[model samples]
Each structure stands twice: as C-alpha cells, then as structure tokens.
Target: MYAGAMKDKRSDSRLVLEKVSHSYGAVPVLNDLNLVVDPGEVVVLVGPSGCGKTTILNLLSGYIEPVSGTVRREGIIRTVYQQDGLFPWLTVSENIAIGLRSVEDPARREKELLDLIALIRLEGFEHHYPHQLSGGMRQRVELARVLAGDSDILLMDEPFSALDYQGRLRMRWELVRLLEKRPHTVVFVTHDIEEAAQLADRVLVLSNRPATISRELHIEALRPRDLTDPAVIGAMKEILKELGLQV
Candidate 1:
C-alpha cells in the first residue's frame, strides 16, 4: 500500500515549480529554482547541508509560500517525516485507522485498516503502542498511516534518517517493494547518496547556497538495485562529483 493499492484510478498527480525563489528575511535559499515532478515518478533531491532541500519540499507541500515564482500541484498529498508521527496514546491499529477516517463505509473502513496492518506485516501488534514497538516498526506504522489515505504524492523528508544503519537498509528495500506493487509520485529528500541511488528514478543534485539543480541524473537501473550495481555506483559517484566532493 505504498501508493498503488489505494491510488485514484484517475490519478494525475504532478508538481511544478516555476522560477521559484525564497529567503528567510535577507538570507536567500532557493534562487530562481524550477522543478517538475511528473505523475508516478520518484525524484530524489540531494545537496550540501543547508542548501534548502527541505525548503523545496515545504514549498511543494504548500506549507510555505515562495518569495517569488509559482508552485503548482495536482491530486492529494501526504508526507512522512524523519521522526514517526504516531500518537503515543494510540495503538498501532488505531494510529493507522486514523488515515482511513474518510472512508464512509464502516465495513470498507475496517477492511482497509486490517489490510494496511497486514501490508506492514504487523498483524499481531495491533494493540501495541508506539513505545512498545521498535523504531523500524514504528516507522512502518507511520508509513502505513500515510498510505491508508487516498494520496497521489508523497513528500518524504529524510524519513528513514532516525533509524540505525541496519534499519535504514531494511526500510530502503521495503520501500522499493511497496513501490513495485503500486507506484506513486514521490519527492524524497535525503543526504545519503546511497539512498538516493537506490531509490530514485531521477536524482536532482543541488548547489550550495541559493540552491539550484546542479545536475539531474536519470537512474536507468531497475529498482531494488544492488549497492554494488554499476548504475548505482555510477549515480553515487556522479552525485558526489556534483556536490563538489572528490569521488
């Protein structure tokens, strides 16, 4: 249920940023930036620290207005942050059920809830609270919650960053598996080049301050890519080079 199983049949979700520029007071961040995210595409943004990666996402999500330019989005949007946003008081099932509240039919709502719980492979942990689950499990639950809704675009801001190394690796593959089932338009921001290489259909590498697309690398390799694969390695190296790092 990453995005496919519950997607709109007429889903035509897209995001476009035209001549976008923004700043905090006098300090500028994105300068004349333009971006387009097509329907059912996964675009990853990578850049130096403080280069306004998250600002781009905020603008796309309409959480903030650009100082100049235009932002256009289509269809429903959902987000998953680095930290899981599950309510501490709610059980795993209840937390996921929150997303399905829009389903007017009681039987349909209950069915979706159970389907999502099984989709995350947490069938027996329905009654478990956030504190009772592991970090990875909690993140999975959070992902499930987002997916339970009718969303077309997923804005992810370092969603797996809080997990340990092993946990991060697992979630990476898990995400690919979910996407394989049903693709959705996703704009993901991460500092990890490996993560970018593994998950992106296209990677947009940004410049320093006043961020702009320094490079756009289309990953031709298939998903669930091996870290050692030539395309993954090549993309990672290219991203490092774009970021002014010696590869």
Candidate 2:
C-alpha cells in the first residue's frame, strides 16, 4: 500500500534528508546519506548488522540529530520498536488511551481509540497487562498506541524480529490489513531480505559500514505476494547480489 506520494512538488517527499551524515564518538556510522520517503510509502532499510540501519531510523524519528546533515519531515512521527516498547505496568487499554488523551478533542479521541482498538483487534485485551498478553498481543498494543497518536509517519525498527515463524507470518498479514485503514508512510529497518520484499514498496539496500545506499528495489507484485513464487525468488536474489550476499 504505497499510501500516497509526498506533497512537495520539488520531490514528492514527505520526509527528506540533505546529504545526511552521522558519527559515534568520532567514528562514522553513516556518511553522506540522502533519502526521501513519500507520504504513504514503506521504505525498508536492509543491511547487515551494525551497518547504521537503526541509526537511520533514529534520525528520522528525531531521537537523535545528525552530525553533518538535515532531516526534513512533513508531519508528526511515531515509532514502534522491536522490543514492543510498552510500559509493562500499564494495561493494554491504558497504553492505547495514553496517546489518545493528548488529542485535545475528547469526542474525536474516543472515536479514534475505538477505531484503532478494532483495527488492532485488541478490543477484549484492553484490560490485559503487557506481561499477561502474548508477544503478538503486546506488539499489537504497541502498534495501536502508535496509531492512536495519529502520527503521519510510522517508524518501525524490526518490530517482528522476536516473533515466532507463525507469529511473524500472521503479523505480516495483519500489518497489511492495519495499514490499509490507517494509511501512513512507514520506514521499517530490518536485516531480513524477505521482510523487506514483503512489506516495503521500496527497499533500500545499504553498504557494510559507514552505510550508504547500494540498491533501491521496487516490488511491483500484488499483495498477498506469494512467498515461494519464482518471481519473488528472482527479486530476492537480485537484492542479495546487490548487497554482496550470495544465496
């Protein structure tokens, strides 16, 4: 669901960076990086570990500032992390409510919360604490919380990495379902080649260190993309080759 293109006539980008670079205690992590994400497109950053993937997510989410460039964002941003990023003490409903409470309009907030609860399929789990819920449920709560904020862009850092195979599979379908209604641009960072292929409209491959763009992939197939089809295999192979990983 490439939600929509960016609003800027200059580039159709909802978010952009100008020659962005970053460092860690004098050690360069990302150098001369520039990227643009359309308003509703999913851009996945795929690379080996320690290749500055998470750093890129951080820069976009405003958790960290760049050392040598700029991040331009068109709207409010929200993030969902691999760890679920939920307050264990809070019930699922509470977590979802916290973000909505800030919406300023009680009527709108109530309506939005109900819609998000239904979207995440967590209506009955509302009173359940994070520890009481399964991993997938916790992830849903995190997603719902992010949605409740009504952020224009969603940043996810391997939110499915910890899920079991079946859970991951279901989450992928659920994500497509959820996004269809929410329709927000997303920047997801993952090391999984197939995950990028399944979820992103565009996949940006990165170099080993001091990460830089290597290849940009466009998955033109329709969704529910067949996981084992030759078409998917061929595109995955091409991306792996571009990343210098033979498979």
Candidate 3:
C-alpha cells in the first residue's frame, strides 16, 4: 500500500464517504479513504506530493466520481482554484453573475454580487476582465464568484500558492474575515504547512499514492495565528513527521 498507515473512524458527517476507493486500470490512487466534513466546519487536506489530495477534492466537487464508496453531500459545492479559473472573456460582474440565474430577483442578485466583490475587497475592479487583474486580484474575483453562488461548501485547491508573500498573507486574513460572516463547510487542499496552520479549523494529513488519512490535527489557536509561537511550531513539526519528513 502506498498509504503508510490508516486510522478508521465510525462517526457520521454532514458529508460521508464509506469504503471510498479509486483506481485506473492496474494502478491505484486512493483506497478505503474515509473522511467527514461537519456542517459549517473548515477542513484542510494536507499530504506529500502525489498523494492524490487534489483528486479527493475533485471527487467531492462532482468533477469526478470515486470508483468505490458512498458519497453524501448536503448541498451545492463551489471551487476556487490556484489558477483562479475565471472566464477570460467575462467581466468581473458578468462572471460573478453566473449563479444569479437561479435567483429570480434582479435587484437582489445585483446587490449580492456587489456585496461579494466588496467583501473580497475587489470593488473598483468589477468591470475589469480576468486578464487585466493582478494575481491576487484574480484570486479575489474567483472567491467572489464562489461567494456569489451561496454554496453550502467550498473546495479550494491550493488557491493561494501563486501569490507573493504579502499577497498570500492578506488573502488569508480576508478569507478568515469572510468565513466569519456566513459560515460554510469547506474542504481546502494545500501543501504549505503554515498555510494550513493559519486557515484550517481541522487538518487532515494523508500519505502517498493510495492515500488515506494518516492523522488529524486541530488548530485551536485563535484567528490571526502567531507564526512564531512555539506551540504552533510543534504542531507543524508533528504533521511533517507524519508525512515522513524531517522538520
């Protein structure tokens, strides 16, 4: 098994996966993978390279299906990707308005989209196309798109990886702020330890290839995490060790 060790849980979740496994012909990528995202909870998925972490997110977002397992989802899910994945031809307003098709009230839809842009702090750039925005701005627009959808859950795949140092910091803070307003369940995947530490309420650590949960870490630290705190460092090191890395 590519997965080193596994811990099985018996509890139920807002979303549940039972005996979940996936493969391609003779090769396998995930086996008996199990996890739960409680209603309105933020869960971050972390693992070493080639661990199939992104694959897990794709499955949950309905982009793909697990070969074997039962998936139970509460409501719609929206994704915010590292590349921002915005429509190149659409203006910011037009892109964020995609979800408005289901909403019948034109005034209400307009109001909500404007609120989303402001919440992500991308107010003045609403008319700009995706190509005209900066990296951070592009990400903000993508996040706004998700918010506009009023999704029940969010699947984020390394969305902040491409930002500059300060840009990532600001985006992290903004994310925390947005989550505070209307809490939604989230499954975020990232390779950065500190990023996980800062953002996730709970962290799921996975192993290589046929990935399964190797460990779960809860971040009890208050928002605006202290990067220099010894306690935080200890938790990070422990997770690195779980991934078979010497930290």
Candidate 4:
C-alpha cells in the first residue's frame, strides 16, 4: 500500500457546492449544503442511509440541478456506483476501451487501454468477459474505465458495498494504490465508518433527511492505516458518535 502523501498546498479546489439545497417535488433532501474538494484530495461522506449522500453526487455530476444555491465544478467528473456497469458482452479490455472511444487513433487508443488494464492489475484478464471475472475484478474494470477518461474528479457512491468483507478490504487498498498513481479530486459516499476512516482525508458526517453537514473530521493518520492503531480506532469512534452510534 502507498503511504498517504502529503497533499500539495498549491492544489486548487476542483469542486465546490455553495449553500446548495435540493428537493424532489416538495420534499427536501439536502438543505443548505456546502462542500469544497481540493485537487487530489479524497473526501468521504457518511451519514444516515437516506441523508442525501447520493443526491450530493447527482448534483456534482450535473445529473440534477440544485433547487437552490449554486453548484460549481472546475473539471470533468466521473462516477462509479455500487454496480459495476460493465457491458456483459465486452471483454475487460473492451469495456475499458469504451472510455477511449473519442480517441481518433486506433493504435493510440489500444495503447492507452493496455496501459489502463495494467494500472488496475487486470493485465492477465484483459481478454476475459465480465462474467468470467470476480466481482472485485469487475469493479476494478469499472474504476479503470473511469480513470481512462482522465477525469479531474471522481465521484464514488458505495463503490465497494456489494463486495464481500475480504474483497472490500482488498479493494480499499487497491484504490489507494490506484489513486497514488493517478490522482484526482474524489468525493466518496459510504455507510461504513471503517471504510470512511480508512480512505478519507476528511470525513463529513450528515444528519437525517433534509441533510446538512453535522460534523467534519480529519483523519491525520498516514495511509495503509492499521485498523487497530489508536488513531484509527479513535477516529472511527468519533465518527460513530457523530452518527449517534454507541461505540
């Protein structure tokens, strides 16, 4: 696992949500929300199941407009959801190649796809179909597909939620390794505090419906963090407390 590199102070804010609020019909989901993600920083959102976490991602991705306030994005955004979103008929290499479709040169596109497959450690399975790979491998392909686009920001919503415990642990470490190689401003949403503690540079805790920022905690521990370490355990406890969970 790569150590958590100190974030460069010069990196600018890539995404900002200023006093943003959103609703479905008459029911509000997010209320007066404000967030800023610096370039190459990983921020995680954790809260009650329906506290507008996914709504925030939708707003950031421009899939939906905020009912009030402003949503400003400085660069291209890509999203990875809980589902892999892989094309059943396409091989791993082919699915990843979808992101490079706009590349005019066939040779250049192929080279890029090959490089991405290597980056995600899918080199051996490039020719394998989605059904042939494990769930974790499929998710890796999804991640590689997103990264292949060279997006400036990544919005991940419970991306590893469907994986088994061991798979989730492995993917968390794999994610850190991948991000170290290809950095991006990331906003990840997860219900798991341990996951948030393990991945986030900063974690934002949200309230129930009509969600608002309830608390913000920064994880100062280095990456490849040990779950048993006092710092990590302390951070997890604090986050759970914020979420009204007894530790």
lDDT of 4 by residue, 152-238 (tens): 688999999999999999999988888877777889999999899998899999999999999999988877776687777888999
Clash count, candidate 2: 0
Q: Candidate 1: worst 10 consecutive residues by lDDT?
A: 1-10
- Candidate 2 structure, TM-score to reference: 0.91
The TM-score obtained by model 1 is 0.95
Distance from true location, Cα of 118 in model 2, Å: 1.5
Please identify model 1 stretches exceeding 4 Å from their true place: 1-11
Tens digit of per-residue lDDT, candidate 2, span 63-102 = 9999999998877788899985998888887888876866
- What's the count of clashing pairs in each model shown? 0, 0, 0, 0
lDDT by residue (1-247, candidate 3, tens digit) is: 1111211110112577778898867779899988878766778999987889888988887788989997777676788988959889999889888856577888899888888888877788889999998998888888777866546678899999999889988888877777776456779999988778888789999988899898999887776666676656777887888887864
Question: Candidate 1 on 1-247: residue-level lDDT in tens?
Answer: 3444445541579899999999999999999999989887899999988999999999999999999999999977888888858899999999998888888898999998988888889999999999999999999998888777576788999999999999999999988876665466889999999999999999999998899898999997888899899999999999988887865
Mark the regions of model 2 whose C-alpha exceeds 4 Å error after superposition.
1-13, 229-231
Candidate 2: minimum summed lDDT over ten consecutive residues — where?
4-13
Show model 3 residue runs off by greater than 4 Å: 1-13
Worst 10 residues of 4 by lDDT: 1-10
TM-score of 4: 0.92
Question: What local lDDT does model 1 show for residue 211?
Answer: 93
